[model samples]
Target: MDKKVTIYDLAKELNVSPATISRALNDHPSISLNTKKRIVSYAQRSGYRINKFAANLSKQKSNTIGVIVPKLNSYFMSSVLSGIEKVANGHNYNLIISQSLESENKEKLNTQTLYDSGVDALMVSLAFGTENYDHFALFRDQKIPLLFFDRVCHLPNCPTITIDNRKAGADATEHLIQNGCKNILHVGGHLKRNVYTDRFTGFKDALNKYGLEYKPSNFIETNLDAAKIEEIIDHLINSKEKFDGIFFANDAMAVACMQSLLKKGYRIPEDIKIIGFNNNPISEIIQPNLSTINYPGYELGVLAGQSIISHLNGNINIESAESILLKHELIARASSSSTN
Candidate 1:
């Protein structure tokens, strides 16, 4: 095997001090841009890999961030993560990412493992059943700068970043109502989560404001998984009243329900108009297209990353800020259009 190149080798080859190379590698602003680029290029060409353990030992920091999300295989989640990675990488920080598979037990376990691995900070989007947030106590106790996004709860000293899910929900419901969807139904996720609970609140608000009588049978609390499509179909089919509209908490569920409805001989807007959240890419590809809410996932991630970094560097007191709410917009489409 070829010899492993060290920083010293690159410094020797480039005629720069080891300290200069180190500063350049850490992306210190003090290092001249030209010199930093030269050092980094030589280091990469010479196969000099960073020894994070040694670096962490010297600086007393891992220069790494940990992230936990409900699922990784989603457009919205992936977009958010991409934004986080972009910001973290620009600042010379590595990210350790894990998924909870929407399980609270798995989320707790992942938290423990990430903490044990010595992450400098942690960002989490809570799991469906993570009502007990005690697992995050270790991070708080250690002052590790914990943050929550999307699905969250109140924990002292921890900052949260999310869109106004309640308003977004109300907008979706109101849009359907404006399109003449009288008997509206709302398919939401577990109310234990703030995201779902808040949206459900907004849904009820729109109904109340529009003078539509809310019916118990018009609401269904689901796991919001795509696999729940069959159950949704069964529920819609068995409903005593002929429902004219639905507002799904996420795009995947809405798309699934729409497909099932089309197969069952239902005209999308004529028989049942629909709206969904997240504005997922697949929403436009579906037959009638989906009307939905545009939640800025990537921007939310970027803000969350910048917030943690700011907190760690003393640039901002994120804990004092408590929460950051991003903007959301409603996108109208053929699925909810009465004229289409």
Candidate 2:
């Protein structure tokens, strides 16, 4: 097996002291530019790689950030991740990403692993079933910068970034009401999550503003699993009151509900109007384009990354538990057209 090249080899070949080589590699201001260039060129030619572990120990920084998400298969999540990676890479930082697969246990395990791996910072979008936040204590105890986006919780001194889910939800529901939907049903996810819970609050507020009676049967809380489409369909059909509009928490569920409604001989907008969140690609590809909120996931990710990096660089003091709300817009489409 071939031995890895080191700074010692570069120093020997360049006939310079190891201290001079180290200073040059680190770009110390005392070292002349020409000498630094020469050492860098020689190191490159010799295939010398700096030991990051030793550097991290010396500087007390790992130069790596940890990110945990619920899952990696969704288009929206992937888009956000791409934006985060772009920003992190531009700042010469490495990202260690993991998926929690919607389990709190898995999330806890991943958090511990990332901590042990010596990540300088951490970012998270909470898993579906994460109720206990004890796993994050290590990062807090060590004073590591921790940030949350999308699905977030209130943690002390940790900044969170997300759209105002309540306002967006109210806007979507109001749009349905404006389209002449008398009996609107809301299809949402677990209320334990801030996104869904706040959205539900907005849904009820809209109904109250319109002088409509808020009924318990008007809300259907699910995991937004496509496999539960049949159950949602049955629930809709079994409702005593006819549903003329639906506001889904996500585009995936909205698309699934649209398909099931069509299969049941109901025409979109003509018979029932629909709106969803996330503005996912499937929203446009469906037979009747789905009306949804443009959540700006990529922009959210970029902003989150920039905020954490700024905090890490001591450019900003993000000690308060502040929430950064991004703007959201309603995109009208065939699914919720008034003319239909």
Candidate 3:
């Protein structure tokens, strides 16, 4: 018997994308006739057989859900995923997860791959560079339930679960302001993302509410990766304003920056009060415990999973679903409060 050949083998031989091969083999109109003919000829010669189980998937409910995240290894994201997995597994549903590595093109590719895999529903946490959302139109067109969590975006009927970031940001800043910090700095990620944008907005709102002046240099936007803590340190050291306090967007960056500042002989909560978001475990482990917002990542994930599953089971209409906002609280720790 001849070995069973797959589309990957065909794509490798034809020097085309797997998507193009799949399209050509399916006689999709978008593929040029020449390309289709070439693919068909090769498939026939090599006895390539499409997986019948996958081919028949649309007719039969696969009981499978797909998820796309910016990155897979974050402490906060892992907690969210744990909640999602617990709910999904309890309901006997399977999850197909992919990471975009924070790239727009990779996110698009993952969307296509998940759609082609016949997922009944899809969940996504947007990538940093995903300005275009057209890749998700197919799911909406096919009446598939789509849900967004954490780093979410607007997608017409798709529901979203997240904290009130603007409020959370404001609270953090106001707390710092109340603690006697006059000149404060916000270390954040790209403003293109809602999480970062909302946090920045909240920070500004707090400053304005307390009659503090806002300067262009007050906000320093970076990739927010921990490895680049030196850049933050440099910005802090080289700046003319001499920031009296700092609010970091995430705990990882906040913790790393705190360590760097301590090593550089800066006093925490005295010289430069600091706080971060997400309440990562490291916040407590550090010498001066990090103050942060309890973002409820795990609860957010459980709610997101349940919401999507509810829509899938016809328990609710996704089109009418409203965005769910989880409550966030300020955790006053040694790093931020002067009293601590």
Candidate 4:
């Protein structure tokens, strides 16, 4: 009575084999419906609890997927996690999620911990400070399915899921230019990450295409922290050339800077049209709705989950796996609309 109730105890009590109990519990199709119902009913009545560790040991599969993200506070990350959870749960796989808090050391530790925990597969969104990726080689060496989403890096045999950030960036910049924006300024994050770098590239390309001169002063490589909005506002206020349009790498920074610029008597659209990447919910809630690139976070997560699952089930060969690039859209709103 004191010990934990297991399938073996339930099997002996119900006069069935342990395999039948497991099959019934897992809803294996080979077991008859009536037999499954009976075994499940009796197991519930007997307080039987599945020992996943033991089952995993016998099957050589943990039936668990590990996920690592930069931070959990963003709406985009939450949506991605939700999509992944939906797909993983539908496949009867459990998730072990961890956040890196944007620290390289923390990300390394989390990766090692998840690998050591015997996860069947691993998914990651790299941290900003993660310059070294040697830590992830453990999963590659072990032949465990490894996937990257959002902020990804190239690793042999590891598939990546992400939107076309460069195109999205160009789309956002072009939208602003179409709305009559010239002398635009780009606010971005660390250029070490592809997302920010690609967006910046797209911005510059759009500027070049529009016959607008690209100047080093027109771009700001920031940390993208909302708390540092004042520094950006000061930069804008003190610039020799007044920017007619602004494009931010992410919505949070755009929204924060918009509020501050407004407080400083700058008018939206009329004074300086603004466009941001990642159509986060806050983009709509802000006073003058923000124009942004619609980065499909949920869809990216779903595809990542499906790809990993397919690889794990042997339905797809990981060695020949191709990286997935989701489409992005430019959403025009009051903040960047010429009509406003």
Task: Give the winner by lDDT: 1 or 4.
Answer: 1
Give me candidate 4's TM-score against the actual structure: 0.91
- Candidate 3 per-residue lDDT over residues 108-131, each given as its tens digit: 999999999888899999999889
Off by over 4 Å in 1: 1-50
* TM-scores for all predictions: 0.87, 0.96, 0.83, 0.91
The Cα RMSD of model 2 versus the native structure comes to: 1.5
Ranking by TM-score: 2, 4, 1, 3
In candidate 2, what are the lDDT values of residues 49-125, reduced to their tens digit? 89888788888888899999999889888888888888999999999999999999999999999999999899999
Selected candidate, larger TM-score, 1 vs 2? 2
Q: What are the per-model numbers of colliding residue pairs? A: 0, 0, 0, 0
lDDT of 4 by residue, 24-133 (tens): 99999999999899999987877777887898788878989999999887889998998899899999899999999989999999999998889999999999988999
- Positional deviation of 69 in candidate 4, in angstroms? 0.6
Q: Write the per-residue lDDT of candidate 1 for residues 271-339, one digit (tens) a residue.
A: 889999999999999989999999988998899889888888888775585699999999999999985
C-alpha positional error of residue 117 in candidate 4 after TM-score superposition, expressed in Å:
0.8
Model 4 pairs in collision = none
